[model samples]
Target: MSNEPDQQSETTTKTNKPSIINVAVAVIHHKDKYLLGFRNAAQHQGNLYEFVGGKIEPNEHAEQALIREVAEETGILLNDNTIVKLGRLHHDYGDKQVSLQVYKIELTVEQYEQHKYCEKGLEGQALTWVSKSQLLAGEYHLPAANKTILEWLKLPSTIVITYPLTHFEAQSNPKGAWLKYHQEKLASDSWVYIRLKDSDSESVAEQLMKDRPDILVILPNDNEQYLDDKHFSTTGDTKTTQQVVAKHLTHSTLIQLFDEIGSSTASIQSLPKDYPLIVSCHDIASIKAANQLAKARLNHNLPPIIGAFLSPVLATQTHPDTPPLGWKAWADLAELADMPIIGLGGLSPTMAEKVIMYGGIGVAGIRQFHQ
Candidate 1:
């Protein structure tokens, strides 16, 4: 597949191939639809769909390149401030390697109303606004490199990390308060990371999974409880029966896995492929480790790393003694990550936009989510 949809000719190969081509991609959103362009059969990865964007110029930053490309191809001038970072993706087609600097632009209502019906591209391509559901369902065929980006696009901007069950039970209506509160707090199609540390957390997770099949519930990777014989049993209410539970690994568990596996590329496959994995990264080292693990799994065509949680972006009451990473430090570390980074700790749903602006794909928190 071709990296540039607008280029009419095949790319010339240099004697020494460059490491990778850096492309700027814009996921222009207006309400529930995203602006897309159809590449002609003559073009590379031709006759398929693509987001509106092009190659980054020598001195141009990703945002600048995206804005220029979008304007050139669609005749829509984009404000630089409106571009929000959506992390990056690196993929290899054997013939070509590309690193996509993906960004998101939420169009104003006026812009959408004016251009929503436009089907003709300013360039020689067909422009269309595809619904998010259509994209997720694979109705529009995108390039192979866009697989992970599309998956990331499906994620909600805010994820609720549940407080321990005990905390919820302490309330007046202990019998059914926690489930009711969670049901109310979580909107349809939202995500919740269950963090209960008690013995019954698995049973509680099973209930949540059954009740809210519309939502995604991620369980912590507790070996003692989730790895025992019952977890993999064929019958009964095992995590595997209803659905394989996605796992969230703490920084320590991630570190341990990385160390135990060493550099054997095949060892990465030891991590279960039946479920998605999310790793918590508190520092640059942990981020690097998580990236390594993700790269290894990608080589094996395993389930992609859902995301990495980078915490303490801001100080909170629970951990006052530990200084917050602040936005600058958090962004620096986040840039090093291969998977989408979710900014956690001292963050609220309201701050999700800011988190994306600072290089995170989403936001996660306990008390803030509870509120």
Candidate 2:
């Protein structure tokens, strides 16, 4: 849980100037593997399987740097039409700091070689296509760079619209929506929108497996309204909602849902309990209920819970001027809570990738489920 900024010092003894500057790199992919190049005998000599592209000069933006560096090293002629911006990375090499902007560009085997990979004195070194499994085996050098590449690779190759089903009402058309969403996911075998509901918590939980059994099932919060008929709540004389939800969905699928900050502290007091997955969704409050719950569970020796910032869609209607929690707050909460948090608000798959890049699990939205 280190919060040290990954940046090098500005003053250098040799240059007497800050070595900090902007740099850009391209993560080129052909199919299941990524195109990785070995560093020449010049830079990081033994650093095997590093991403292509290089440093940005003054008066040049990240895109410009990537285009120039790719051509220089691989002789690939890239245009504004070809390069796609993925995201940016900030790292401190101790001697120099760089705000590394990353891009993902696709090329065919013929195009890659036609570019004259080693025409100049750059020295092609060695080029290979690496899969995620091989990358995770720790055979590659540059652990930090490998981690960055892994993060990008985990992202869904195709756009995924994730719907967060917190209630039956949120589904627009519950039965039909679930059927259609499930069929599409099964056909493509690519995307899924988790339905989070508590009505017939057991029956609905069972149907999840019978229907689109492969997709993940997230249980909705035990709000008072939903619990009134279900006979469950965090407080009062009744079985805690968490216990009921856990009992039914534990074996069915990975449970995903937000815990009310205030009640979560008491809800998850036991340790090493068998629960599929947990997400705490406490808003800005004095006690930081989510963090307290995570600490208590961690202290008791339970598994880590996923943290989430709950931005109510109703808030957009009532408080349009209020801004949702940004990446920094989400990252801070995840670090403090010692858990990965997902963005819960008005979000889509494209935005979810952005959230994950900024240190989150992903995005969950109620509106997204209907679509």
Best by TM-score: 1
- Tell me the tens digit of each residue's lDDT in model 2 across 1-371: 00111234422546655455666777776555666676544343244457776767778887787877777766666773355444444445455455556666767766655643433324444666677567656567642533444444443422233333332356777655654554454424333333344354444433433454344333433332132214323234232232222211121111221243335544454322643234435344411444455445444545334333344322343346767565566555443433344555556546765665555545554444333
Q: In candidate 1, how many Å is residue 148 off?
A: 0.8
- Give candidate 2's error at residue 293 in angstroms: 20
* Tens-place lDDT digits, model 1, residues 1-371: 12353332333355545356788998898879998888888777788898888888888998888888888877787874477666677777665667788887889888888888888877667889999999988999988877777767766788888766677666886426777777667667667776766664555555666676776667666462352224435336454343443677788878877775565655466565666688899898898789878766666777778789898899987789988999999999998888788999898889988988888888988887764
Task: Give TM-scores for every candidate, taking all chains together and pairing residue i with residue i.
Answer: 0.86, 0.49
Question: Whole-model Cα lDDT per candidate?
Answer: 0.75, 0.46
Whole-structure CA lDDT of model 1: 0.75
Give the poorly placed runs of model 2, Cα more than 4 Å off.
1-18, 40-45, 93-96, 108-110, 113-121, 131-139, 157-188, 193-371
Task: Write down the RMSD of all candidates, one decimal each.
Answer: 3.5, 11.1
Each model's total of backbone clashes: 2, 0
TM-score: model 1 vs. ground truth: 0.86
| lDDT minimum window of 10 residues, candidate 1 | 1-10
> Which pairs of residues have clashing backbones in candidate 1?
2-44, 2-45
